[model samples]
Target: MKARLPFIFIIITMMLNSIGIGLILPVMPSLITELTGGSISSAALWGGVLATTYAVMQFFMGPTLGNLSDRYGRRPILLISLVAMGLDYILLSLAGTIWWLFAGRVIAGITGATFSTASAYIADISAPEKRAANFGLIGAAFGVGFIIGPAIGGFLGEIGPRVPFMAAAVVALGNATLGYFVLPETLPQSKRRTFDWTRANPLGALMSIRKIPNLTGLVVVFLIFTISHQVYPSVWSYYTIERFDFTPKMIGASLGAFGFFMAIIQGGVIRMIIPKLGEMRTAMWGMGLNFVVFILVAFLGEVWMLFALMPLMTLGAIAGPALQGIMSKLVDDDAQGELQGIFASVTGIALILSPITMTSIFKYFTDSDAPYYLPGAPFLASSLLEISAMALLFVIAKRIWGTAATPAQ
Candidate 1:
């Protein structure tokens, strides 16, 4: 337990942050509708406003935060971000108007780079041999958080939405205190690089990517894979609502199910499989499985079928550590901060693009009063993108890393 302290802290912090986010999402439409004189579209647009604010802030700050962590070390960045996250939750809890909620979201987004610092912390403490396992733990944190967060949110939401928000704020502040006191700094002073504001910009992260050999193709592959993966978040709620008439609780659970599968696979299975199948093959297998599972999801509209399909989503979880391991291998020790920043920024860019493109396609096909709303279209399109991404990933593995590419042993 002592040796695992840092990992535990990072995981707990992530869990708190996620729970804060989950608490607000399910009940917000009603809160806003009542506040705004019963306009459904206003509620929807307000929701979008909060998300857009978060995405935009994350888009700009991800690389800068990563680079800052590289220079200043992970502990300070993590602590500061946690404090900000606590405030974000508190603001949301007190928010009386839609704009207040939007303000809270924007603050949360600016502070949300906690994940990047956490990633740097993992990179700092992990041995080459243990990096994948450690990173898998990070993914597990996400899964467990999402799983419990919404369940708690839904239960508390029954009492009142503000209750959940206040609870989340309290939890976030508690976690922040714990992290400040208990979490050790992973990056030692000698290895800490100087922060360069000009170079820490997102463009700086991208430009630095060009300096590395064969990284451009790998980054492109990662972006493609991210785009393919966005279907789960971008449209899952809408689909579930339209298809099964799921309530807020059910929708939360559905989202939680995806995270649940991710936690199981990356948390348990990835560590075991990586040593045997090796990272590259494991990644390829995961991608292939995601393609199949998503397509299956499109066709299988039944509620039970979704429950069954949950395990299949785990395939994508393996790809995360596998690809991160590859990226770690691609860069030298000194460049870890910049490289991780690049990785996060590229992911941010993917998050920006994927939702817009996939949602547009979904709207294009399903604008009708049909019984089913053709809810599976986005998943099918996602599958096609996944297939293309998998092919590119395999090609990269073959050429640069080669088949059977194990993390440095």
Candidate 2:
């Protein structure tokens, strides 16, 4: 039990990180609408811009922070990020204009790159055989947070749009204080390396790929998969409002449901499934699930359909941890931070493209003058992207790892 304390702290920290995001999501549309004095459609465009700004910073800074953790150890970087994240929420809570919000997102983006360091912390602690299962635990933590955050945020949003932001700030700062006392140094001095700016750029991911030749195909799969996944956070709020006329409270409830089911699938179900199916087949099956859900979401007619779809919507979460475990094996132990950083960069790239593309599609399809009004257009696009990811993943997995390699054994 004593040995499990650090893992507890780490999982709690991850949950807090996600709670910070989820706590604000239900209110973001209204907040953006408030600040910009625009229609929901226009506010969505700005929302995309805000998300893109955040992603842009993460793209540039992810590798840098990952390397910094590699050199200086994970404790300082993780603590610093948590504190900074708290401050970003504080700044956002007080924002009076769109630019202030943008400034806050910039700060949030820079600090958010620490996600790589956190993933490395998990890598540092886990046995190779259990890594994928543990990554699912991380996903479960994220899901659990989402379950609480939106419910709280939706409730608080009735008080004021900014109320959730202030609440999120408190959660973040308090978590950082707790972490300062309990979080141990996972990366030892012997494993530390000098930080090189050259290796911390686009070259970093390329350099990693150069070292692990099989990673190139996986990276391609990762990119497309991430972009497809972004459709949710990018436009879900707006889509629901336009199509179903959902209130902030309803939106929160639905999102909470999504997270609840995701927590179950990732936290408990994956442990049973992955041991039976290797990472390769687990990922393929998960993606296949996601593809079906995307298509269902694209054609959904009523709010109940969404709630009905929640189980399948989340069952696909196995793909993320499966992919993470697969890639974790491709790198040396010392380079774990770098590997997660590379994927962060890949996620950043997806974030930068997905929001703008998705929101624009949302705007265009739902506008008064649209040739054909269809609020579900973005989900259609996502389904196409997901199917593409599935096809490529199968081809690449067969070519590289064969049918029976990397059994999570």
Candidate 3:
């Protein structure tokens, strides 16, 4: 229990960090639109801009940070991320221009790979068998933060967009100060890997994937699942506004429900469920269920429908840690940093692509009353992609892990 203290602290800090981000997310589009004197479409475009900008920066910096963490130890890296994040939030609160928002997001994205480093930190301390559960706990922290953060962000957004940003800034700053003392270094000098640019660069992670047997298959499965998953963030804000005629606060509240449902499934349920179900089987179940939910979301008209389907969305989140665990099991601890960095980059690629795809579709089809008429095509397409991803996962499992591998033991 004493040894687990650092993991607890690190996970808590992560929760706080995500909560800060989540709190601002729901209201951001509307706030930016108003601030920029742009159309709602323009607002939605900026939302993608902010996210893609962040993801692009993350795509570039994730491996670098992870590699550096391996050499310098996780404590300093973690602290630096927290401090930089807090400053990012502060800058967000002060932004009076659209460019300011863009700059803030760029900083936040570059520094936000704190989670990747956190993964490396968790790996540093835990045994192989325990890594899945610990990583699951990290996933749970994100779910909990998203659950609570949106509610706070929604409530505060009614006062002003800047108000929520200020609040997020304060929370981030406070977490950094507490984390300095509470979070200890997990990677000792004896275990540190030498940073190799060939293995740690943005292209290097993908290029290196082919050299490792079975890893390419796993990465392929991972990439497909992530691309479908990226759709929600890339388009949901615009979806809610156009479909339900929701205001910023209302959007925040709806997203809050989404986060709450995620917390229930991934945070509370995964711990109990994973030990019984096994990771691969559990992930397949999650993907199949997500496919069903997203298909329904495509056509559903009522705001109440989103509430009803939130649980389904939550169920889909189970794939993440399950896959993360699989990746951890397949690789050695020394390479966990590089492997997770590659994982971050693949997801970043999805983040990069999902926006341009979804928003273009939305803009082409969306009408003032389209939500009542046809809100299902994008979601339906997303569902098909999910189903395809599940098929790929199974094919990968059989081809790589062999027919002897079963999702559930």
Candidate 4:
């Protein structure tokens, strides 16, 4: 039990971090709408811009933060990010204009890159054999946080749109305080490397992934998969509101359900399935499941259908931990932070592009004078993207690892 304390603390930290972000999900579109004088179309556009700004900052800074953690320590970087995130939430809570909200998201993005550092921290502590299960802890934390966050945010949103932001700020600050006292440094000084700016750029970081043996193709597959997954975060709130007229509370409830399902699958089902199917097969199956689910989401006529389908969607959670487990074994201990940072940078790039694409499709199709109305267009696009990712994964697996490779234990 004593040996597990640090891992427990790390899980708590992840949960708090996700909760702070998730708390705003149910309220964010409404907040933007209220700020923009109640225009849903305008809110969708600005929401995309806000999300784009956040992703833009993360794209540039994620690798840098990862490198910094490699040089200094994960504890400091993680603490600093938590504190900064708290402050960013405060800024958002007090925002009087669209620019202020954008400013807040920019700050949040810069700090949020700590997620890569957090991943590196997990890599530091876990053996290669245990990495996938440990990595699923992060996903579990996300699931738990999302479960609670949107519910709380929806309830608090009834008081005021900005209330959830203030609550999130408090939660972030509280987590930072707890971490400062308890979170141990995972990367020791002996294993630390000096930070280099040249290698930390997004392009440079991506290039670094190519240098790793038997990893580049898989990294490409993950990037495509990440972009495809971004459709949910990019348009879920707007789509539900536009198509089903879901209230903030209803949106929160839906998100909570999604999170609950994800947590259960990532925390429980993954551990069971990965040991049997192996990481490569697990990833393929998960992506294939997601492809089918996204197509179903595009055609669903009733909101209850979403609830019924969400549990099935959670099966897709296996792909990430499975892929990460495979990559973690390919890199040396010292470069773990670098690899995680590169992954974060790839996700940042996807986030940057996805919000623009998903939100634009949503806005255009839902327009009053549009040729045809189809709010589900974004989900349809996501399905197509997932199919592409699945195909890429199949080719990479065949060409790189071959058919008889043993499962990642």
Clashing pairs in 3: 298-375, 298-376, 299-376
lDDT of 2 by residue, 196-275 (tens): 99867854555556677678878888888888888888998888887898778877887888778877886689888887
Better of 3 and 4 by TM-score: 4
Judged by TM-score relative to the true structure, which candidate is superior, 2 or 3?
2
225-315, model 1: which lDDT tens digit per residue?
Answer: 8878877766665566556766667766766776777777766788897778776777788788888888888877689988877887766
lDDT of each: 0.74, 0.84, 0.79, 0.83
CA RMSD (A), model 4: 4.0
Candidate 2 lands at a TM-score of 0.82
- The runs of at least 3 residues in candidate 1 whose Cα sits more than 4 Å from the true structure, single-residue gaps closed, are 1-11, 28-49, 63-83, 93-99, 116-140, 176-196, 274-280, 325-338, 363-372, 394-409
Per-residue lDDT of 3-100 in model 3, one digit per residue for the tens?
66787888888799778878898778767877889666667667877777888888877777888898899989888888888888889888888998
Q: Sum up the clashes in candidate 1.
A: 0
* TM-score of each candidate structure, all chains considered together: 0.77, 0.82, 0.81, 0.83
Would you give me the overall lDDT of model 3?
0.79
Give the clash total for candidate 4: 0
Error of 2 at 225 (Å): 2.2
Clash pairs for candidate 1: none
lDDT, model 1 = 0.74
